[model samples]
Target: MSLKSIFAIPFAKLATKKVYKWANKPFQTQEKVFQKLIADAKQTAFGKDHDFENIKTYEDFKKRVKVSDYEGLKPYVDRIVLGEQDVLWPGKPLYFAKTSGTTSGAKYIPITKESMPTHIKAARNALLFYILEKKDASFVDGKMIFLQGNPVLEDKNGIQLGRLSGIVAHFVPNYLLKNRLPSWETNCIEDWDTKVNAIVDETIDENMTVISGIPSWVQMYFEKLIAKTGKPIAEIFPNFNFFVYGGVNFEPYKNKFESLIGKKIDYVELYPASEGFIAYQDSQTAPGMLLQLNSGIFYEFIPATEFYDENPTRISIKEVRLGVNYVIILNTNAGLWGYNIGDTVEFTSLQPYRIKVTGRIKHFISAFGEHVIGKEVEKALKDSIKDTAINISEFTVAPQVNPESGLPYHEWFIEFENEPENLDDFTQKVDDSMQAQNIYYQDLIAGKVLRTLVIRKVKKGGFHEYMKSIGKFGGQNKIPQLSDNRKIADVLQNFLIE
Candidate 1:
């Protein structure tokens, strides 16, 4: 490791001490953690009943409040974004973290003032972990490149300044401001097309020590780095010490990245969203660094199986189960109440709420960790697909294990507007994409988990028809890009090769 990585480790160790202590010792109950907000929400804010009517026990809060997505909290978010009274979190929110989700589309989530401490804690968690792992906090203390999203300038209302990533950046202490990659303003852009290319050009020769972003965006940057420089990525940013990515799963793309960079730089996976920084990469081998819930947010877990039920069970930090997958629902100090953030998690252990992200409950496959879930497969395909005409409009995956072979096979059905004339080559590319991206799938293919491989090309408009049939075209619910089985998968299954 370099000087920065080694020098900054003690600080990282101190960070571990703080965050681990915080995680291992979360509150006894949700109410105790969120008493202030529950008290505040009782007052009608913007003429809405957002407060706990009589929520006392953790059970009472779980029963009184249902898990919410963006739609469920639209009323609260709409009000808070308009700068109304504090509805969800206490005190005035500094800014909205305008982030994009596959389900909600684009949401400007409010980051309340009280929640700033939580964000700071999570940031410290990531920084601390990087330092501890590298044995060098000064490296991170030096310049770091957070290849993040910029705010959207919306004229819908007069002077609506929206930056999903910027809101988080807005909270960075002035002392750490200079440490940010691409001097806040210098790196941001109105046109993503030009902005991304420029990001590649500027850092091609920089002494970049740390690089962080969502995995999809980061992998794309890697591809761009390779295409433009025509040199291996290590040559592009030789001084780069670590890759810290969050907001999306990186496991599926691990192989592709390893293939590109030649050797693995230290990698950190963070779990931050519009709401707040959820988890960080402290132990390189652990599932995930359990978030410091003292971020002033109340975290609730709904068993993955219970996610869609009228009223499935909800468990608080006090009652979380280890080894079981759960849908993470958050009641952030950021004006979100009983929000189901749509992430599935498994506890590394229950003692301190250490968790590993299993998969989105809505998207995980139980049969074989095929986990062909939406996010995993999406990341896998996004990292794999190098063709433009074959850009997936919609797709879903199902494991059709051959009974005779006693092995599962990944059968994918995809909708594409542009069909390559050489269908065989196109299909091979998809298979290659999967093999190169998912080590498990690659191993399965080598083994029998995939006794065979198949890719089915569905009719151009068929997937849309299936989505329409399900009354889901766009918005909070679109056809999941990957799944165990659905109309899209069934329809496209016939196209797979035996």
Candidate 2:
């Protein structure tokens, strides 16, 4: 198909009626989820909305319910599991997606049957769109390689709670679920040391097509895949069509993956959270596809620009303006209602409500008043080694004040396969990128006061193995991009420096 016909979009025109329906209907569904939360939140959340003294109507619920993070909602989740209809998604506990949250501590996120339909609808819509864009939906539908965490949800005790992704994995259409592809659990979960060894045996036989997962684990597997196959990745899986990833950005991973595969793996953005599977990339560059099931969420926005301290300028879904950087706030079924998802995003365009996820609200290095966001850190890393062919699999940034120097500088611990040429020069270039973006760091870099950032290289699968050791596998939670305090920082510090 020609670019004119294929890329043609009068999206506003195409989404005319549909767009109106989406904006308006979602608010109503949000209202239903809020009813239970509004009553339950009365005791715990203090103020349910951001600033409202008391929650009354749907609007009041939006006003009174403070935009909350995962930590804030734990009490309500406890109330919910005890048989309170705290948030009104459909069905029983079925199971909680076993997720070790960033701040909520180790916990189970409820996934209800009532709201699960939206997850299926949203995931399907994302897939349907990729097919429709190509005009041939079934062209590459032979086998799907889901690089997912197959963690069994365990209760407080050590027994296997059940596989989290297996909930949707088993529910997948039978015929399409092929025997050739490896089941996510077949030595996949980062469990015993034997699991990784088992994965090598099970996955080596089949040629894969589409691959999906977070970038950190995917790169880990690729290293193993390369070592096992001995041949280039393309030769191992010539049928590969796309690399669909959620939880972290894919811009940097593109070149390395393409180089490995000997072809460009089409990149697809996925927004899967412990709360629920949210948005996805409609086309590679269509700003991200909104989940078709927002009808079940009462969505709100908190401007990241306004997140000076903990307080943020909150706006309701209908009240949201375009081209604004805001943290995602949701009132969803299955317990969490009127909650701040702790993610930041901006609307690229409207009609279909297209948005760009800027970064997570809390996942930035703002400790030193520089206000460095995840997006900025990504840019800095990309520019640092512009000439070299090194791609970062996973990285975390922390604003550390050297006890002797007394100057706060950002410490970036990046995971790469091997060190690129001119490591010192590469670090300098990254400093240049940082100075250009963050003022405080810029001053330090220009004055030569910067503590000369440290870059440590780890063994190939170290990060992957680390995550598994903690019970955070492929299917569990978002990669820890930017941690808040020293608790996680200490854990990361032991492995980072020489």
Best by lDDT: 1
lDDT of 1 by residue, 158-255 (tens): 22446556546666666566666665454567454456677777776666767777654565577678988787777776767678776545554555
lDDT minimum window of 10 residues, candidate 2: 4-13
Candidate 2 lDDT over residue span 1-498, tens digit each: 333224323332353345346545655645565555555445433332243236667656644555556677777566555655433333345567665555556566777665556666566556655655665533244456665555344453222244456556655655455633555567345653355456556666665666776665566566677878787677777777777777776665665676667766677777866576667777665666564335356567777877665666666655677867788877665556666767888776555566667787767765555677777777778776456678666667666665445545566667774467787877777777777877876666567565655555544555655666566655445455665455445566556536
- Report backbone clashes per prediction: 19, 15
Each candidate structure's TM-score, on Cα atoms with residue i matched to residue i, is: 0.72, 0.80
- Predictions in order: lDDT: 0.63, 0.61
Candidate 1 accuracy as lDDT = 0.63
